[model samples]
Target: MPTGVAIRDPREQLFNAAERVLLRDGPSALTSRAVTTEAGCAKGVLHRHFTDFDAFLAELVRDRIARLDATALLTSAGSGVVSHHLTVALTDLFGSVAVAIVSLVISRDELRARLRRTTPTGIPLLTEAAAMLGSYLAVERELGRIDAGCDLHVLATTLIGAAHMLFADRTGTPPDGTAVRRVVDSVIVGALSTPPR
Candidate 1:
């Protein structure tokens, strides 16, 4: 890299590089050098864009969280099988770099603290996931798909936790769709007022 080579969207490039590093070599291999090298930019590029490496990581997680398609989930409330939608969502989320991102968050205290400033609650990815699922469940409840008195918060948490466990097994390939659907069905069974369609 040259001294004055302008890199378009350095932040995104750096974030993508970090994601590649995190996904390929795990959190332990991720560093300012690793990210900059992967981005094909100078180390100063990262420092100039972010307050620090942790700041970069925090922004990465936030970027990923922002990418989750809440609108699709929300709009699916009145139509498709709830479990099916959740199954696809969970599978897509964990199948990507999300599980690795979760690991990265857990490995770095500074990143966690920085994220806490914005996410002030549970783990970033999982917390937002639960909220997404919870929002979908709330819509379902209104549509009479689930029991009127169902506790959506609890249901959403259960679904996310259970689904996360199924996909967190990075030791092997992510669980197949059937496996995810099973977890979804088991967790949401008690609350369903109407049969899954």
Candidate 2:
């Protein structure tokens, strides 16, 4: 709001503001001005930190990707029910601004091109999400929980894709936990070395 007022962690502030705009107004409504206005900071603050709006958006997507935590998923490989762990992880992922961020990336050509320099292949948020699941699946395979011959890459991608669709478009509320668990269990059933729980 003020040109000279101190704002600590502008990048995080801007990122949060952008997420709000993206979630509330959708990708078409997002702009440097929109983000700055949402953040209550000067529009020049965005330019000072990023070469352009696309650059800022690229970092936002990357930052979201970095925040996808796989620790619980990885550690649950041998102990917890595989399908249950997967359900929780996928549900948590889609419950965030991820669906909106994915939509934002798809709507912006320049942003996508800029992201490609670092990502090189696949959509940024979705690809990283697939990788997170893949890593957990790999751990399960190592522990003999998942079938030896199952292609984890495909499984992981399928899970992310299916889960994304489930959470992508909705009116009032996210899909119920039972709905999410059904999707996770359906995708993971054939891959489990043991019978599905």
Candidate 3:
């Protein structure tokens, strides 16, 4: 009963459906039949778009990672201390996105290869996050809000990794907000503190 205008790009629709399935029931529920059924399309529609179920899953994961990177880019622009923005930004990154990544990483060899191929060799997300943290600290130092002469890059990496572990809770709910704030602020202060040389 679907006409050209009524029908969306099946590939796009399929990917969106897969994301919902992933968020709801996790990745194991993402078979071609399940995706097609969820998308309300023919089962053959999957194959018509992706090479196989694994390829489709890998593409889904790739699309998510790209979206996360785009989010970090737009959100980080003109943002303040990693304390405020980092937690929420990282909540998005290390939260659902990280879970999806771990799922794909644990899947079959070809899927793993596809993920690796889609991802750049280095983890630019971490690097960019750290750079952003450094910039924030550098600005604070200039403003007399904090002392300087600190290695912002190193501190940024530490904060990024720490944020991942701290906030990537398996439980649906996040941990205490104030506690997270203290941890992030402490790390920033400790790293950027102006100490006598």
Give me the candidate number with maximum lDDT.
2
TM-score of each: 0.95, 0.96, 0.67
The deviation in Å at residue 3 for candidate 3 is 10
How many residue-pair clashes does candidate 1 contain?
A: 0
Task: Estimate candidate 2's alpha-carbon lDDT, on a 0 to 1 scale.
Answer: 0.91
Each candidate's lDDT (Cα)? Answer: 0.89, 0.91, 0.63
lDDT string for model 2 (24-115, tens) is: 99899998999999999999999999998899999999999889888988878899788989999999999989999999989899999999
- Candidate 2: clashing pairs of residues: 1-40
lDDT of 3 by residue, 75-181 (tens): 54344554566556555566555655555456556677766664544343444455655666566556654545667677668777777667545445655666666
Residue pairs whose backbone atoms clash in candidate 3: none
Best by TM-score: 2
Off by over 4 Å in 1: 1-4
TM-score, candidate number 2: 0.96
How far residue 83's Cα lies from its native spot in candidate 3, in Å, is 2.0
Clashes of each: 0, 1, 0
